[model samples]
Target: MRNGFKIISFFIDPGAIQPFVQNAGFQSGLLQTIVDDRWSETNRDVYAFWPRLSTLYNLNNNQPSTWWLRNGSFLRLKQVDLGYTLPNLKKVAIKSSRLYFSATNLFVISKFKMWDVEMGGNGLGYPVQSIYSLGLQVNL
Candidate 1:
Protein backbone atom coordinates (compact mmCIF):
# COMPACT_ATOMS: atom_id res chain seq x y z
CA MET A 1 0.00 0.00 0.00
CA ARG A 2 1.16 3.54 -0.76
CA ASN A 3 1.86 5.94 2.11
CA GLY A 4 2.55 9.66 2.30
CA PHE A 5 1.75 12.27 -0.34
CA LYS A 6 3.55 14.29 -3.02
CA ILE A 7 2.01 16.91 -5.26
CA ILE A 8 3.93 16.59 -8.52
CA SER A 9 3.17 20.19 -9.44
CA PHE A 10 6.76 21.12 -10.18
CA PHE A 11 7.32 18.28 -12.57
CA ILE A 12 4.05 17.67 -14.40
CA ASP A 13 2.19 20.93 -14.09
CA PRO A 14 2.97 23.00 -17.16
CA GLY A 15 1.26 25.90 -15.46
CA ALA A 16 3.96 25.83 -12.81
CA ILE A 17 7.07 26.19 -14.89
CA GLN A 18 10.27 25.47 -13.06
CA PRO A 19 12.96 28.11 -12.89
CA PHE A 20 15.82 25.65 -12.99
CA VAL A 21 16.93 23.35 -15.73
CA GLN A 22 14.79 20.31 -16.42
CA ASN A 23 15.79 17.06 -18.01
CA ALA A 24 14.77 16.88 -21.65
CA GLY A 25 14.00 13.18 -21.35
CA PHE A 26 12.06 13.33 -18.11
CA GLN A 27 9.06 11.08 -18.67
CA SER A 28 5.84 11.42 -16.70
CA GLY A 29 2.38 9.93 -17.14
CA LEU A 30 1.63 12.90 -19.37
CA LEU A 31 4.02 11.52 -21.93
CA GLN A 32 1.75 8.53 -22.32
CA THR A 33 -0.90 10.83 -23.71
CA ILE A 34 1.16 11.80 -26.72
CA VAL A 35 -0.64 10.24 -29.63
CA ASP A 36 1.37 8.29 -32.13
CA ASP A 37 0.99 5.46 -34.61
CA ARG A 38 0.78 3.11 -31.62
CA TRP A 39 -2.63 4.57 -30.84
CA SER A 40 -5.55 2.95 -32.61
CA GLU A 41 -9.31 2.65 -32.35
CA THR A 42 -8.84 -0.29 -29.99
CA ASN A 43 -7.02 2.06 -27.58
CA ARG A 44 -9.96 4.43 -27.26
CA ASP A 45 -9.85 3.77 -23.53
CA VAL A 46 -6.75 5.98 -23.44
CA TYR A 47 -8.23 9.31 -22.37
CA ALA A 48 -6.99 12.56 -23.87
CA PHE A 49 -4.25 11.01 -25.99
CA TRP A 50 -4.40 13.78 -28.46
CA PRO A 51 -3.02 13.60 -31.98
CA ARG A 52 -1.66 17.15 -31.63
CA LEU A 53 0.84 18.45 -29.12
CA SER A 54 -1.06 21.74 -28.84
CA THR A 55 -4.13 19.94 -27.54
CA LEU A 56 -2.07 18.20 -24.86
CA TYR A 57 -0.57 21.52 -23.78
CA ASN A 58 -3.99 23.05 -23.38
CA LEU A 59 -5.22 20.13 -21.32
CA ASN A 60 -2.29 20.42 -18.92
CA ASN A 61 -3.33 23.94 -17.91
CA ASN A 62 -6.27 22.61 -15.93
CA GLN A 63 -6.30 22.51 -12.11
CA PRO A 64 -4.49 19.80 -10.19
CA SER A 65 -6.27 16.53 -9.46
CA THR A 66 -5.72 13.01 -8.16
CA TRP A 67 -3.68 12.33 -11.26
CA TRP A 68 -1.03 14.67 -9.83
CA LEU A 69 -0.73 12.84 -6.53
CA ARG A 70 2.09 10.35 -6.15
CA ASN A 71 3.35 8.10 -3.40
CA GLY A 72 6.03 9.90 -1.37
CA SER A 73 7.45 6.87 0.44
CA PHE A 74 11.26 6.84 0.55
CA LEU A 75 14.24 5.18 2.18
CA ARG A 76 17.21 7.36 3.03
CA LEU A 77 20.69 6.70 4.32
CA LYS A 78 20.64 9.71 6.61
CA GLN A 79 23.89 9.47 8.47
CA VAL A 80 26.80 7.28 9.46
CA ASP A 81 29.62 7.64 11.99
CA LEU A 82 32.78 5.62 12.53
CA GLY A 83 35.45 6.05 15.12
CA TYR A 84 38.69 4.43 16.21
CA THR A 85 40.67 4.95 19.39
CA LEU A 86 44.42 4.81 19.33
CA PRO A 87 46.40 3.04 21.99
CA ASN A 88 48.33 4.97 24.65
CA LEU A 89 51.05 7.14 23.10
CA LYS A 90 53.33 7.81 26.08
CA LYS A 91 56.42 7.63 23.86
CA VAL A 92 55.14 10.57 21.80
CA ALA A 93 54.22 12.60 24.89
CA ILE A 94 50.54 12.19 24.07
CA LYS A 95 48.53 10.19 26.55
CA SER A 96 45.82 9.02 24.14
CA SER A 97 44.45 9.73 20.70
CA ARG A 98 41.39 8.89 18.62
CA LEU A 99 40.09 9.41 15.11
CA TYR A 100 36.53 9.56 13.83
CA PHE A 101 34.52 10.01 10.66
CA SER A 102 30.96 11.04 10.07
CA ALA A 103 28.61 11.58 7.18
CA THR A 104 25.04 12.76 6.70
CA ASN A 105 22.44 12.72 3.96
CA LEU A 106 24.34 10.01 2.15
CA PHE A 107 21.63 8.96 -0.26
CA VAL A 108 17.94 8.35 -0.78
CA ILE A 109 15.87 5.64 -2.46
CA SER A 110 12.47 6.74 -3.69
CA LYS A 111 10.06 6.48 -6.60
CA PHE A 112 9.69 10.27 -6.54
CA LYS A 113 12.65 11.11 -8.75
CA MET A 114 12.06 14.81 -9.31
CA TRP A 115 13.66 15.73 -6.00
CA ASP A 116 14.05 14.58 -2.41
CA VAL A 117 10.71 13.17 -1.33
CA GLU A 118 11.06 14.82 2.05
CA MET A 119 10.94 18.18 0.30
CA GLY A 120 7.32 17.34 -0.50
CA GLY A 121 5.53 19.48 -3.08
CA ASN A 122 8.18 22.17 -3.07
CA GLY A 123 10.33 20.97 -5.91
CA LEU A 124 11.91 24.40 -6.21
CA GLY A 125 13.40 24.07 -2.77
CA TYR A 126 16.98 23.00 -2.30
CA PRO A 127 17.49 19.30 -1.74
CA VAL A 128 19.07 17.85 1.35
CA GLN A 129 22.85 18.07 1.34
CA SER A 130 25.38 15.29 1.78
CA ILE A 131 28.15 15.96 4.29
CA TYR A 132 31.32 14.09 5.25
CA SER A 133 33.48 14.84 8.25
CA LEU A 134 36.70 13.53 9.79
CA GLY A 135 38.01 14.37 13.21
CA LEU A 136 40.67 13.54 15.74
CA GLN A 137 40.93 13.86 19.50
CA VAL A 138 43.90 13.65 21.82
CA ASN A 139 44.36 13.80 25.55
CA LEU A 140 47.61 14.78 27.16
Candidate 2:
Protein backbone atom coordinates (compact mmCIF):
# COMPACT_ATOMS: atom_id res chain seq x y z
CA MET A 1 0.00 0.00 0.00
CA ARG A 2 1.19 3.49 -0.82
CA ASN A 3 -0.16 7.03 -1.07
CA GLY A 4 -3.82 6.08 -0.65
CA PHE A 5 -3.18 3.05 -2.86
CA LYS A 6 -3.36 -0.57 -1.74
CA ILE A 7 -2.47 -3.93 -3.27
CA ILE A 8 -2.79 -7.61 -2.32
CA SER A 9 -1.36 -10.77 -3.91
CA PHE A 10 -1.79 -14.55 -3.59
CA PHE A 11 -0.41 -17.71 -5.20
CA ILE A 12 -0.25 -21.49 -4.67
CA ASP A 13 2.54 -24.03 -5.14
CA PRO A 14 0.34 -26.62 -6.89
CA GLY A 15 2.87 -29.25 -5.85
CA ALA A 16 4.48 -31.31 -8.57
CA ILE A 17 3.05 -34.61 -9.80
CA GLN A 18 4.52 -37.70 -11.39
CA PRO A 19 6.45 -36.70 -14.51
CA PHE A 20 3.75 -37.83 -16.90
CA VAL A 21 0.65 -38.18 -14.75
CA GLN A 22 -0.67 -34.64 -15.02
CA ASN A 23 -1.22 -34.70 -18.73
CA ALA A 24 -0.46 -38.21 -19.83
CA GLY A 25 -2.51 -41.06 -18.42
CA PHE A 26 -1.17 -44.50 -17.42
CA GLN A 27 0.57 -46.27 -20.30
CA SER A 28 -2.10 -48.97 -20.24
CA GLY A 29 -4.92 -46.44 -19.83
CA LEU A 30 -6.72 -45.25 -22.94
CA LEU A 31 -7.38 -41.63 -21.81
CA GLN A 32 -4.61 -39.06 -22.15
CA THR A 33 -4.78 -35.31 -22.03
CA ILE A 34 -1.68 -33.61 -23.38
CA VAL A 35 -2.32 -30.23 -21.80
CA ASP A 36 1.20 -28.89 -21.68
CA ASP A 37 4.27 -28.93 -23.89
CA ARG A 38 6.52 -30.07 -21.04
CA TRP A 39 4.83 -33.46 -20.91
CA SER A 40 6.54 -36.29 -22.79
CA GLU A 41 4.95 -37.88 -25.81
CA THR A 42 5.78 -40.82 -28.08
CA ASN A 43 8.45 -39.28 -30.33
CA ARG A 44 8.70 -35.55 -29.53
CA ASP A 45 12.17 -34.85 -28.10
CA VAL A 46 11.71 -31.27 -26.89
CA TYR A 47 11.47 -30.85 -23.13
CA ALA A 48 9.62 -34.12 -23.07
CA PHE A 49 9.54 -36.59 -20.22
CA TRP A 50 9.04 -40.35 -20.57
CA PRO A 51 5.42 -41.31 -21.14
CA ARG A 52 3.35 -42.30 -18.07
CA LEU A 53 3.85 -46.05 -18.31
CA SER A 54 7.53 -45.76 -19.08
CA THR A 55 8.31 -44.07 -15.76
CA LEU A 56 6.25 -46.47 -13.64
CA TYR A 57 9.39 -48.08 -12.19
CA ASN A 58 11.44 -44.89 -11.95
CA LEU A 59 9.09 -42.42 -10.28
CA ASN A 60 11.83 -41.11 -8.01
CA ASN A 61 14.10 -39.92 -10.79
CA ASN A 62 13.23 -36.23 -10.28
CA GLN A 63 16.42 -34.73 -11.60
CA PRO A 64 16.93 -31.24 -13.03
CA SER A 65 16.99 -32.75 -16.50
CA THR A 66 13.42 -33.85 -15.85
CA TRP A 67 10.62 -31.30 -15.87
CA TRP A 68 9.11 -32.55 -12.60
CA LEU A 69 10.60 -29.68 -10.59
CA ARG A 70 9.28 -27.18 -13.07
CA ASN A 71 9.11 -24.45 -10.41
CA GLY A 72 5.42 -24.24 -9.50
CA SER A 73 6.20 -21.04 -7.62
CA PHE A 74 4.41 -18.04 -9.09
CA LEU A 75 4.05 -14.33 -8.38
CA ARG A 76 0.84 -12.36 -8.97
CA LEU A 77 0.08 -8.67 -8.68
CA LYS A 78 -3.36 -9.66 -7.36
CA GLN A 79 -5.10 -6.41 -6.54
CA VAL A 80 -4.36 -2.70 -6.51
CA ASP A 81 -6.38 0.37 -5.60
CA LEU A 82 -5.68 4.09 -5.74
CA GLY A 83 -7.87 6.82 -4.31
CA TYR A 84 -7.84 10.53 -3.64
CA THR A 85 -10.23 12.71 -1.67
CA LEU A 86 -11.23 15.95 -3.25
CA PRO A 87 -10.63 19.08 -1.21
CA ASN A 88 -13.77 20.16 0.68
CA LEU A 89 -16.49 19.87 -1.94
CA LYS A 90 -18.93 21.89 0.16
CA LYS A 91 -19.16 24.41 -2.65
CA VAL A 92 -20.73 21.69 -4.83
CA ALA A 93 -23.23 20.74 -2.07
CA ILE A 94 -21.06 17.72 -1.22
CA LYS A 95 -19.09 17.19 1.98
CA SER A 96 -16.39 14.86 0.71
CA SER A 97 -15.90 12.48 -2.15
CA ARG A 98 -13.08 10.22 -3.30
CA LEU A 99 -12.44 8.57 -6.63
CA TYR A 100 -10.61 5.31 -7.02
CA PHE A 101 -9.55 2.68 -9.48
CA SER A 102 -8.70 -0.93 -8.76
CA ALA A 103 -7.62 -4.13 -10.36
CA THR A 104 -7.47 -7.78 -9.35
CA ASN A 105 -5.25 -10.62 -10.51
CA LEU A 106 -3.54 -8.04 -12.65
CA PHE A 107 -0.69 -10.19 -13.86
CA VAL A 108 1.51 -13.18 -13.10
CA ILE A 109 5.11 -14.19 -13.61
CA SER A 110 5.98 -17.88 -13.56
CA LYS A 111 8.25 -20.44 -15.12
CA PHE A 112 5.68 -23.22 -15.07
CA LYS A 113 3.92 -23.72 -18.39
CA MET A 114 0.19 -24.33 -19.15
CA TRP A 115 -2.67 -22.26 -17.75
CA ASP A 116 -1.24 -21.78 -14.26
CA VAL A 117 1.60 -23.57 -12.50
CA GLU A 118 -0.53 -23.50 -9.38
CA MET A 119 -3.17 -25.56 -11.18
CA GLY A 120 -0.70 -28.48 -10.74
CA GLY A 121 -1.97 -30.96 -13.27
CA ASN A 122 -0.52 -29.82 -16.58
CA GLY A 123 -3.14 -27.03 -16.77
CA LEU A 124 -6.20 -29.23 -16.24
CA GLY A 125 -7.69 -26.89 -13.65
CA TYR A 126 -9.50 -23.59 -14.00
CA PRO A 127 -7.26 -20.57 -14.47
CA VAL A 128 -7.07 -17.56 -12.19
CA GLN A 129 -8.86 -14.40 -13.32
CA SER A 130 -8.05 -10.70 -13.71
CA ILE A 131 -10.52 -7.87 -13.06
CA TYR A 132 -10.54 -4.07 -13.21
CA SER A 133 -12.92 -1.62 -11.56
CA LEU A 134 -13.50 1.99 -10.61
CA GLY A 135 -15.59 3.57 -7.91
CA LEU A 136 -16.30 6.69 -5.86
CA GLN A 137 -17.18 7.38 -2.24
CA VAL A 138 -18.88 10.41 -0.70
CA ASN A 139 -19.58 11.56 2.83
CA LEU A 140 -22.13 14.21 3.64
Candidate 3:
Protein backbone atom coordinates (compact mmCIF):
# COMPACT_ATOMS: atom_id res chain seq x y z
CA MET A 1 0.00 0.00 0.00
CA ARG A 2 1.19 3.51 -0.86
CA ASN A 3 0.93 6.34 1.61
CA GLY A 4 -0.24 9.83 0.73
CA PHE A 5 1.81 12.67 2.20
CA LYS A 6 1.13 15.70 0.02
CA ILE A 7 -2.27 14.61 -1.17
CA ILE A 8 -3.98 17.40 0.76
CA SER A 9 -1.80 19.93 -1.03
CA PHE A 10 -3.50 18.92 -4.27
CA PHE A 11 -6.74 20.18 -2.79
CA ILE A 12 -7.02 23.43 -0.79
CA ASP A 13 -3.91 23.97 1.26
CA PRO A 14 -3.34 26.79 3.70
CA GLY A 15 -0.55 28.32 1.62
CA ALA A 16 -2.61 28.42 -1.53
CA ILE A 17 -3.69 32.05 -1.93
CA GLN A 18 -4.88 31.95 -5.52
CA PRO A 19 -7.94 30.06 -6.54
CA PHE A 20 -7.41 26.62 -8.05
CA VAL A 21 -7.82 26.55 -11.83
CA GLN A 22 -8.45 22.85 -12.27
CA ASN A 23 -11.34 21.11 -10.54
CA ALA A 24 -10.32 17.54 -11.30
CA GLY A 25 -9.27 16.48 -7.81
CA PHE A 26 -11.33 14.03 -5.74
CA GLN A 27 -12.67 16.71 -3.39
CA SER A 28 -13.29 19.30 -6.12
CA GLY A 29 -16.79 18.07 -6.88
CA LEU A 30 -17.65 17.90 -3.20
CA LEU A 31 -16.29 21.41 -2.69
CA GLN A 32 -18.34 22.61 -5.63
CA THR A 33 -21.41 21.05 -4.08
CA ILE A 34 -20.66 22.90 -0.88
CA VAL A 35 -20.32 26.15 -2.81
CA ASP A 36 -23.51 25.60 -4.79
CA ASP A 37 -25.52 24.65 -1.73
CA ARG A 38 -24.23 27.41 0.52
CA TRP A 39 -27.27 29.56 -0.11
CA SER A 40 -29.86 26.79 -0.46
CA GLU A 41 -30.52 24.44 2.42
CA THR A 42 -32.62 22.19 0.13
CA ASN A 43 -29.66 21.51 -2.16
CA ARG A 44 -27.38 20.29 0.64
CA ASP A 45 -28.67 16.74 0.76
CA VAL A 46 -25.72 15.41 -1.19
CA TYR A 47 -23.09 16.68 1.24
CA ALA A 48 -24.95 17.67 4.33
CA PHE A 49 -22.44 15.86 6.46
CA TRP A 50 -19.53 17.81 5.02
CA PRO A 51 -18.47 21.16 6.44
CA ARG A 52 -18.64 24.35 4.42
CA LEU A 53 -15.72 25.39 2.27
CA SER A 54 -14.90 28.25 4.62
CA THR A 55 -14.83 25.83 7.54
CA LEU A 56 -12.57 23.48 5.65
CA TYR A 57 -10.31 26.34 4.66
CA ASN A 58 -9.99 27.33 8.28
CA LEU A 59 -9.32 23.70 9.23
CA ASN A 60 -6.47 23.60 6.71
CA ASN A 61 -4.36 25.71 9.08
CA ASN A 62 -3.86 22.58 11.15
CA GLN A 63 -1.40 19.86 10.19
CA PRO A 64 -2.41 17.14 7.78
CA SER A 65 -4.59 14.35 9.12
CA THR A 66 -5.87 10.89 8.28
CA TRP A 67 -8.70 12.51 6.33
CA TRP A 68 -6.27 13.03 3.45
CA LEU A 69 -4.87 9.53 3.67
CA ARG A 70 -5.81 7.16 0.84
CA ASN A 71 -5.41 3.49 0.12
CA GLY A 72 -3.01 3.31 -2.79
CA SER A 73 -2.68 -0.44 -3.10
CA PHE A 74 -2.96 -1.75 -6.63
CA LEU A 75 -2.72 -4.85 -8.83
CA ARG A 76 -1.06 -4.24 -12.18
CA LEU A 77 -0.36 -6.32 -15.27
CA LYS A 78 3.28 -5.33 -15.53
CA GLN A 79 4.53 -7.45 -18.40
CA VAL A 80 3.64 -10.30 -20.70
CA ASP A 81 5.54 -12.30 -23.33
CA LEU A 82 4.47 -15.04 -25.71
CA GLY A 83 6.58 -16.97 -28.17
CA TYR A 84 6.34 -19.93 -30.54
CA THR A 85 9.19 -21.99 -31.86
CA LEU A 86 8.99 -23.80 -35.18
CA PRO A 87 10.32 -27.30 -35.82
CA ASN A 88 13.69 -27.71 -37.54
CA LEU A 89 13.50 -27.36 -41.32
CA LYS A 90 16.23 -29.48 -42.92
CA LYS A 91 15.24 -28.54 -46.47
CA VAL A 92 15.46 -24.80 -45.79
CA ALA A 93 18.66 -25.31 -43.73
CA ILE A 94 16.99 -23.55 -40.81
CA LYS A 95 17.85 -25.13 -37.46
CA SER A 96 15.38 -23.11 -35.42
CA SER A 97 12.89 -20.30 -35.95
CA ARG A 98 10.87 -18.44 -33.37
CA LEU A 99 8.38 -15.56 -33.16
CA TYR A 100 7.54 -13.64 -30.02
CA PHE A 101 5.34 -10.81 -28.79
CA SER A 102 5.85 -8.83 -25.61
CA ALA A 103 3.97 -6.10 -23.81
CA THR A 104 4.38 -4.04 -20.63
CA ASN A 105 2.38 -1.77 -18.36
CA LEU A 106 -0.87 -3.16 -19.68
CA PHE A 107 -3.39 -2.31 -16.93
CA VAL A 108 -3.93 -1.66 -13.23
CA ILE A 109 -6.62 -2.51 -10.72
CA SER A 110 -6.76 -0.21 -7.74
CA LYS A 111 -9.08 1.63 -5.36
CA PHE A 112 -6.82 4.68 -5.49
CA LYS A 113 -8.65 6.84 -7.99
CA MET A 114 -6.40 9.89 -7.63
CA TRP A 115 -3.32 8.48 -9.37
CA ASP A 116 -1.13 5.43 -9.90
CA VAL A 117 -0.05 3.88 -6.61
CA GLU A 118 3.36 2.93 -7.98
CA MET A 119 4.19 6.60 -8.47
CA GLY A 120 4.34 7.13 -4.70
CA GLY A 121 3.14 10.06 -2.52
CA ASN A 122 1.54 12.74 -4.69
CA GLY A 123 1.90 10.83 -7.99
CA LEU A 124 3.11 13.95 -9.80
CA GLY A 125 6.05 12.28 -11.45
CA TYR A 126 6.19 10.90 -14.99
CA PRO A 127 3.44 8.42 -15.63
CA VAL A 128 4.11 4.76 -16.37
CA GLN A 129 4.41 4.05 -20.10
CA SER A 130 2.95 1.17 -22.09
CA ILE A 131 5.14 -0.72 -24.56
CA TYR A 132 4.58 -3.47 -27.09
CA SER A 133 7.19 -5.42 -29.03
CA LEU A 134 7.38 -8.23 -31.57
CA GLY A 135 10.37 -10.16 -32.69
CA LEU A 136 11.48 -13.07 -34.86
CA GLN A 137 14.56 -15.22 -34.43
CA VAL A 138 15.93 -17.67 -36.97
CA ASN A 139 18.97 -19.95 -36.87
CA LEU A 140 20.36 -21.30 -40.10
Most accurate candidate by TM-score: 3
The lDDT for every candidate, in the order shown, is: 0.50, 0.54, 0.52
Model 2 clashing residue pairs (backbone): 78-105
Model 2: residues with Cα > 4 Å off, grouped in runs: 1-21, 24-67
TM-score per candidate, in order? 0.58, 0.57, 0.60
Output the TM-score of candidate 1: 0.58
In candidate 2, how many clashes are counted? Answer: 1
Model 2: lDDT to the true structure:
0.54
lDDT of 1 by residue, 80-101 (tens): 7666777678999998777777
RMSD of each: 11.8, 6.7, 12.9
Each model's number of backbone clashes?
Answer: 0, 1, 0
Instruction: Single out the weakest 10-residue window by summed lDDT for candidate 3.
Output: 4-13
- Candidate 3 residue-wise lDDT, 45-121, digit = tens: 64332333354445532345444454555667777776777666878988888777777877877755655556654
Ranking by lDDT: 2, 3, 1
Model 1 clashing residue pairs (backbone): none
Q: What are the runs in model 1 whose C-alpha is more than 4 Å off?
A: 1-57
Query: What lDDT tens digits, residue by residue, belong to model 2 across residues 68-115?
Result: 444456676666776766678788789888788878777777664435
> What would the TM-score be for candidate 3 when compared with the true structure?
0.60
